[model samples]
Target: MPLMRIQLDSDRQTARRVVELHRTGKVHRESRDAARAEVWRRGRTPAGETVFVGTTNGEPVRLIYDVEVYRDVTA
Candidate 1:
């Protein structure tokens, strides 16, 4: 299925931890996808969203992406 990024949260350390887990094979949850060695530590809300907690500046404060997700496509 086609997926889209709807939300990102950089307000908590849990967010960073989730992102690290997404890119690397370190930590994970049973509800998470396990098809690959490393998993994308992201999840969809009951409202139907794809959230991500990614970092850019290599710092906790630098990682901030509290947003939302959806199945909408852009042109």
Candidate 2:
């Protein structure tokens, strides 16, 4: 089975929320500071993350996205 990958920014609690949403109900490591992140298809719709990286002065502003993907390869 081919796994999916989702990437989010490391600012504005964006990554935190993405990880929480994709995260499975079943706990694995139970660590708030997990070095590695996990990816999951929530509700089968999204395809990929849409990040808009730029700067105005000295801060980096990014827009992240979580795609909902629905596809039954077995069927």
Candidate 3:
């Protein structure tokens, strides 16, 4: 699977919410528009920023906030 890295600069609350939603399987619900938007995992940087890891699966998806995005080629 292709991995994606989403870095939330300063929005810790949103990042926490995203992680929680994914943990509860709400983000992967088929009834939602973001059906393919599944957060595989999450972590924190040394600087205290929240980072989310997910897969594109070749489908387009959107995030809640305007943040930096990168393709995790190493994964």
Candidate 3 structure, TM-score to reference: 0.29
Q: Model 2 over residues 30-74: C-alpha lDDT tens digits?
A: 221121233332334333442222212223433333333446456
Q: Cα deviation of 73 in candidate 2 (Å)? A: 23
Whole-model lDDT values for every prediction: 0.40, 0.35, 0.36
Global CA lDDT of candidate 3, please?
Answer: 0.36
Candidate topping lDDT: 1
In model 2, the clashing pairs are 44-69, 44-70, 45-68, 45-69, 46-67, 46-68, 46-69
How accurate locally is residue 49 in candidate 3, as Cα lDDT from 0 to 100?
22
> 1-75 in candidate 1: lDDT tens per residue?
344332322345655576677688554352132211122345433233233445555433433233333444559
For candidate 3, lDDT tens digit of each residue in 9-41?
Answer: 324444456657867765523312222232323
Candidate 3 segments exceeding 4 Å error: 1-10, 28-75
For every candidate structure, what is the RMSD over all alpha carbons to the true structure, in angstroms?
A: 9.5, 10.9, 12.7
Show where candidate 2 strays beyond 4 Å: 1-12, 24-75
Could you tell me which residue pairs clash in candidate 3?
none
User: Which candidate model has the greater lDDT, 1 or 2?
Assistant: 1
